[model samples]
Target: MADASPKHDVFQAIADPTRRQLLKLLVDKEMAVTVISGHFPMSRTAVSKHLRILSDAGLVRERKVGRETRYSLQPEPLLELKRWLSYYERFWENKLNVLKHLVEIDSETGTDRTGPNRLKDDQTPD
Candidate 1:
């Protein structure tokens, strides 16, 4: 049986710098493949390939206007990535808060929690 999975996920789609720039270009306006290709150094075919990946990821929507094919950004799929990253953001925040508290304690006690300057509780200077 054929694989039912999408050809590209949002992570894979945006993994390439070119594809990320393409999405940025389409954020405010849709453009035909020709116009989109003009913004990059690559050929139109290359741009189309990037668009295809974005389309597979549901990160872009394409429309046919007569002979031209125009593409636009579809940001809904990116919510998954945002949600995933937000969890790590909170994790880092907690770590940073702990470090901040350690720094504050070290300053008040005239001790260093890091490097060779760290001192034990009984080693305070006179």
Candidate 2:
């Protein structure tokens, strides 16, 4: 039986700026390779390679229309990236909460926020 799994993960596919731009282009509507290539400075073959990576990662869908192949965004795989990032969101929220508490304490105590710990005008750090 043929393997049904994606050859590349969403994270790997979107690691490149070119591939990310390709995803953005297809988000609104599908486009043929020739049309898509016009948006970037690279050759059509280069754009096609990026599309192939996105397709391998299951982040894009391609269809043949006569002699041309059209590509569209397949956002389902991005859910994995979303879930991974959501996990870190809580970590950042906790840090923000701690900073808020410290600021509240400083306000209550009338502590100089611009004290020795902070940099002064014309003071450059090493």
Top TM-score prediction, candidate number: 2
Error of 2 at 49 (Å): 0.4
lDDT of each: 0.88, 0.89
Q: Write the per-residue lDDT of candidate 1 for residues 1-126, one digit (tens) a residue.
A: 998676899899999999999999999998999999999999899899999999999999999999999999999999999998998898679767766767788789887567776655445332
Runs in model 1 lying further than 4 Å from the true structure:
1-5, 98-126
Q: Candidate 1 overall Cα lDDT vs. reference?
A: 0.88
Q: Evaluate model 1: give its TM-score.
A: 0.75
Candidate with the greatest lDDT versus the true structure: 2
Off by over 4 Å in 2: 102-112, 117-126
Pairs clashing within candidate 2: none
